[model samples]
Target: MKGSQLGEENGRRSYESLRRTAQALETRADIARAALRLFRTRGWAGTTVRDVAREAGVSVPTVYSTYGNKQGLARALADAADLTAGVPRQLAELEAAAADPPRQLAAMAGYDRRLFERAGDVLRLLREAGRIEPELAAVYDDGRVRADETRARVFSSWPDGTLRPGLDLRAATDVYAALCTVDVYTTLTAERGWSPGRVERWWSDALARELLDR
Candidate 1:
């Protein structure tokens, strides 16, 4: 009977701890969303921790504790962008398409399209914020480097003789990364008024033509 009571007590403690943890995470998410909105409207340099706190309906200290500073918030926003872009699922699908290079390239284009369509504003925010904040700049650069590495892995997974005769993995990754940058996507979708579907189709056809053997 004593052991049963003790186990029940422990379970209650665990449940309480988990509830607190979940609440903290939800608060952080709310703060991050508020920060993104402020950053988008007011500009990164123009927004402040107090502003985010007010926007999130939390204390300024809460904002600081959750994100440390504006740069930290920017990092969180980058993470949010990744989540919104469906990167993990897309990567899994990309890996599964290794046997078919055309299909893989098309998948890559699809990921790019979804990324820009869903998270372009967040990415643009990061890029703009990175210009003035050295730490945020590092974060932005790190994201780009990681993306390049992912592209390299995808290219490396291609079957033998799948690439154009002269195009090696490194070269192929360079081209792919360059062509799929947020800047290019912005140019096509924002500046040139091309639809996401149009961009996806163009990228799919373009990448296949550039990298594959006839």
Candidate 2:
């Protein structure tokens, strides 16, 4: 009887441990998705811990206990997005292109056209959703900082067709970064009422005629 009781207790403990771990994972996942949706849609001013909790179907205190506050949630979103391999994914695509400059440029153009298309649209949509959510105010900006780092890598090439050529990558990166600002694009589109197709056309043409073409 004693042996059987001990075995049963051990099994119960094991099940509890596994359950706790599963719950933690699910909670973290929910927090991440909620942050993404909330931050992107509303900005920090519009989103609140309550909003995130509502979106995740958790509770206000749950988000607070998990992340400490809105800024913590923003950092969490940044770390989570970094884990998604987006920056590395682009680098891999660039590496796989042929050695020829023009061919490589063509490949990169195609790659980035697809990339920017989604990024632009998602950010724009996020602007709408985040407007009412206070917890997401800094989240989009934080993500942009990560993207700026990637853009800097893209501009390290010399005009002479050498890829990632310069000793100082930031110089090239800043110029390209300035041109690719989301705010500028948003102002052009929302304030000026430009269509996405037209903006994309300009993006493609700008890269082709100005930067990569040289």
Candidate 3:
């Protein structure tokens, strides 16, 4: 029947469209991975779009068409880093413990550890690159602001009297954010050779003791 044929054609077109979308996403992921490797090894200032294209086995035009420029590629790499770091799952853990300040703080520490373990290189790369690149600097600044807001929201959600005496929500958020910074993590883990487990344990205990009333 004519109606049946029309439905079949539509189904075929839908399938083709889905396939193309998946392919495009896969290509972008490949480019991002290639860019990450180059950036990590050569530094952002040293890596070029041509190098990324060669590493990804794509054409230079493809790289330009896909990402626009180095900044766009950096953004893609940042996104991929978050995905590899399981940021969504970590956020969920924090959200699930919203009612329990101690548990929430512990989850925050866990999130910090996991993100550093998986994406510390990417973060460090962006931070170093941000010095010369205005766009990258803005991205880094935005990340800091978001991190502060996230901690503030978590602190604001706690029940009354959760914080230590004389510590307000804003103060608690500042303390938590300060302790959770990537610089602190790198200092202990990279400079002092402390294990991530040790850092997490210390942070968890420190956050609880500093922010929560006995």
Q: What are the candidates' C-alpha RMSDs? A: 3.8, 8.1, 3.6
- Per-prediction TM-score, please? 0.77, 0.52, 0.78
**lDDT (C-alpha) at residue 105 in model 3:** 86
lDDT of 1 by residue, 6-112 (tens): 99999999999999999997898788778877877897778888898999999989988888987778776776677667787787878787688888888878887
Model 3 lDDT-worst window of ten: 79-88
Question: Where is the poorest 10-residue window by lDDT in model 1?
Answer: 75-84
Which of candidates 1 and 2 reaches a greater TM-score? Answer: 1
Distance from true position, residue 11, model 2, in Å?
Answer: 23
Give the Cα error of residue 47 in candidate 3, in Å: 1.8
Off by over 4 Å in 2: 1-29, 36-47, 59-66, 76-144, 156-160, 163-168, 191-193
